[model samples]
Target: MLLPSLYFEEGFKVIGNMVNTAFGKFNLTGKTALITGAAGLLGQQHASALLEIGATVVLTDISAEALGAACTALSCESTASRILTRVMDVSRAESITTVAEEFSDRRIDILVNNAAIDPKVNGDAGIQETSRLENFPLVQWELQLAVGLTGAFLCSQVFGSAMASDGRGGVILNIASDLSVFSPDQRLYRKEGLPADLQPVKPVTYSVIKAGLVGLTRYLATYWAEQGVRANALSPGGVFNGQGDEFVTRLTSLIPLGRMAKADEYQSVVQFLCTDASAYLNGQNIVMDGGRSVW
Candidate 1:
């Protein structure tokens, strides 16, 4: 059926406005984003996403060598000038403070708390034995929490405070995991013929750190709402990072998508959370886990 000319004109205006607003919100030209653990796989991907939208990205990691390599890998003629690297230990307040001071002259419009000590559960018999909850080391527990949970808190406190004090408003994106909302299926890590005591399991620290991030996200979302700083978390599922075939098969069977996520799959959502595209979104955990949590 043909529409009236007047209706057509009004519809066209509404459609045009929506298109313009959508594109405008995603644009990050002149904004600056700082990412902790910037040398890691997901960290580099987050930096790439923000940089693609014209944001200046500050990549921070504890290892200068690793950060250097990441910078070299991400550098291209078009975005070379937009990429900056800093050696920072998230577990240390002074380290985070130093970086904040160095960038004091510029507005940090976005903060991506992507740092974490994710203990890989390779099926090495020795590793499996040590990873058991009963055998888990206290030193390892402290280190993981220090880097993952406390580090996010400290970064939010320093840079988040700066964003609030500036009164210009900012965004905080906490990198969580699908395990945040659910317990790990330890069966995925089971080794054939391994006795119960020798079986490898997902470390306890991973869950606690991620769950803590979600809680922190909620707290900060309300704590700084009036200050114009928004906080949110992204909980991603397992990524296909060269895990053994047996483990991959078992894990993928649990996901409806029948596959693990690619390293770059979460980039777009990272962009959305860090940009005005998600302006009204706050204090929520977005799980992108191939529908695994539902199962």
Candidate 2:
């Protein structure tokens, strides 16, 4: 039985299209996440987690090199095709808009605002007892705010506004510091080589910026409540990769749990905030300290 050439060609095309559609629907599918600061530790972890659970992750970072490196690493994985990379300055409106447009419908399902910079601290030991506030340099404050608070607002306002209009009620998770929730009580704080004035007062422009993030999340949540968009903050405790024994000992002691938090310890908490598991959890700051702030 000879079949017509045109019929054979059409049948082949139909089969191919079915396979492609099935693969698209079944492959780590369901929602796209736009992760800002995607090169940082927490940002990488967050993106990887989402990828693990079947997400199309759009990555953005201030550094093209770092972002390229991360995207390269993710691409090597079997699921690498799910990752998208872009250079974005979260503090800038135009940058976010440019990236947002890359998504097919201008509807991003998730936004992770995880960009921040800790200000450079310069001071001498036991200077709190002697230094004056007026002597600290002003440049440090400017740098800190530029990266931390200003950047967060830029992403939130733009990404958040888009999400509000998208109608799916997307989720926003702002990475904040546990220090934002409760002030760190590191006793006998000392930094050598810092100016006397910069030493005595708490120069937590980083933490203060994070504190502002909490309020931002809440206010956005309230305004967008009717819109399907939810916003929340996840404040992590001091993440110590390898502080010296003395530094770790001094800092961990203040933590009632007696140890600094490991990086992966934050995974579960962060995943919760970013997932459907926390569908009703909105406008709240979840602190991931090991009981340090409470103590």
lDDT of 1 by residue, 135-188 (tens): 999999999999999999999999999999968989999999999999999998
Task: Give me candidate 1's TM-score against the actual structure.
Answer: 0.95
Question: lDDT per residue, candidate 2, 1-295, as tens digits?
Answer: 9989999899999999998864443332577888888888778878887787688898889899999888887776537778888998876778777777766464678888888775423334553532233544467666667667777777777777887876768888888888787764534355555554445445657567889989889987898889988899988887887766766788787788899887668776766677766778889999878887787
The RMSD of every model to the true structure, in order and in angstroms, is 1.7, 10.9
- The lDDT per prediction is 0.93, 0.75
Estimate the TM-score of every prediction: 0.95, 0.80
Model 1 steric clash pairs: none
Residue 136 displacement (Å), model 1: 0.4
Candidate 2 achieves a global lDDT of 0.75
Using TM-score as the measure, which candidate wins? Answer: 1
Give the total clashing residue pairs for model 2. Answer: 3
